[model samples]
Target: MSGNSRYRILFAGTPDTAVPSLDALVGAGFTIAAVLTRPDALVGRKRVLTPSPVAARAAELGLPILRASRLTGDAGRETLGRIAALDLDAAAVVAYGALVPAAGLEMPRHGWVNLHFSLLPAYRGAAPVQHAVIDQAAQTGACVFQLEEGLDTGPVFSRLERDLQPGETSGAVLADLAVSGAELLANTMGAILTGTATAEPQRGEPSLAPKLNQADGFVDAARPAAAVAARINGTTPEPGAWALLEMASAPAEEAGERPAQQRVKLLGAVPEELPEGTADLPLGDPLPGHLHRGRTAVHLQCADGTVRLVQVQPAGKKPMSAADWARGLPEGTRFQAEATAETATEGP
Candidate 1:
């Protein structure tokens, strides 16, 4: 509706990524009827109960909230009915992490809209932002689209483009998009309410971004160096990508002779071009997973090149830079992980 229409809107989301749009609506004077967020769950150091980030923010802003696992079935249907009966001009979702179903989708007078983290028709699904970084996409952006029953295939109301800076973390990219999407939403929604909003059909071939799982972080040194480096940057900060190590061969383990085995997460890395004449073949003489420099660089030989390790953390240990941890390792230490070991045993 117009900026001055004083329309009632239902907001749905559950994480930090959704906060910006919610805040923008309040700031722009939209009448928010209720915030629909996930139920509180146990989390962190002491395993204490914690509210969904969206819920916490909504409470802070004095907005009513509707917490539900998913809006389905008769019980959920009743909730949807109530939401629809609220005379909401529109319902908006951003990273809500649940399906709205047809019931809720039909409730609002203006239907539902979603603030997806990727450019529409590209990277359309859960984990789009993370996948974009991992895949090294040239660019990524946010798209505000009217929600259909299908997943993220709706016609776009508006889209904003953003460049994916080198070595940008997924969290950073998401934060950037959230604010961008909020501004776009405020403008686009204002237009739709005032009869100026336009929806454009997605033209390119459809691609999917499946939800990322814990196993997605496992990194094997045998792959090409570029792939390994990309994986490291893509999955950092959560479900962190990592490799395994044999304690006896581990540089850190050699000094203290501590545990017999360990798992180390590679949070960050720096890829280096190979020197000439290192390998007899056209490729340089980098040995997969073998450390070239133990301390300063945590340098390792990959399939075709070298990667200088930056940040790392052993299991149950705080993260530290590779240079800091390398001091304790021997001069010729190597990194070995379970995935590599399994591959070795499995044979080529």
Candidate 2:
């Protein structure tokens, strides 16, 4: 790394978002020792074998690739030997799914670095962007950290912050942070090559960002509208916010054992106040998820207030505006209040 030649960097990544970091390092004139990516997998409609996004990019760049399915046991040692053979100055990981065993971590003289989304010690795990938006964080960013034995528990070299704009979806926030973090990672590498960068142990209240799943996207009506709105924002374009609206007015014959409720995925929503008298209600209003139909928009009473639906997708149908979904609903239909609310907190 101290030589006159360009620093040799081993890049490990799998997804599309991680491509920017690779590009940044290459654009900054770093000689990528080799690219490490996940093995090809069956993807899409026909289930054809397809390379990961990073792998595709590495192919385009004509970089050497190390396809790893597991980085443990004999495989880990083989990967370590490969790293040693490369004589890498350092290795950078961005959303590399597999764990980097200690052998791989210690192989690079300059150490293994990770470009993690979210300011470290907070939202540190697989799904930081989703958790940040779910927690309604005003601002979140990226950090470059030395990958150690712990899960994202490492010394931080640099940090960059991005504002969480109003109604921004998790996907949008991640996209923005990817670009900034890619730039930060490249700069951090440049500084390290010059022996100017320093890393300190992470501080503050640490929180876990566990992987998000379909269950995490449920919009439980028993919770306040803002909380439901958070789910919509955080879950968009993935396991999108889903709920079951009850058709109270529909006859049993019409329903015909249709499970009483219809499933809907919320693509867009805005937490807002219920109109006029509906907001006041009785002191102990019993119906929390009562549907309130409007001419142009659809409003529904919630635990604390109401939510105006923007866009949604019903089961077996294409995505459509909330107003359109509401128009198709039977009269006096409402979303059933969740029997039990999710007790999990987003983050510290």
For lDDT, the strongest prediction is 2
Q: Estimate each model's TM-score.
A: 0.87, 0.88
Q: Report the lDDT tens digits of candidate 1 across residue range 1-348.
A: 435448888999998989999998887788899999989999988989999999999999999988887788776777777787689889889988888887678778888988898887988889898888888788999888999999898899999999976656677788888898998887777777778888998879877888887788877676666667767777876568787665444645568765444678887765666444322233544457666543245655666567767788977889898768766665334565334533432321
Local distance difference test, each candidate: 0.77, 0.83
Off by over 4 Å in 2: 1-5, 253-259, 275-286, 340-348
At residue 28, give the lDDT of candidate 2.
82
Per-residue CA lDDT of model 2 for 1-348, tens digit only, reads 434246889999998889999999888888998999999999976999999999999999999999987789887778778878998899999998988888778888888999999999999899999999889888899999999989999999999988886577888888888898999999998787789999999999999999989989988777777777788889886667888887764457476754377888888678887666543234556466677666767776767667887787888888898877777776557776664334222211
The RMSD (Cα, Å) of candidate 1 is 4.7
Q: Candidate 1 regions off by >4 Å? A: 249-260, 274-284, 294-296, 337-348
**lDDT, residue 212, model 2:** 88
Over all chains combined, what TM-score does candidate 1 have? 0.87
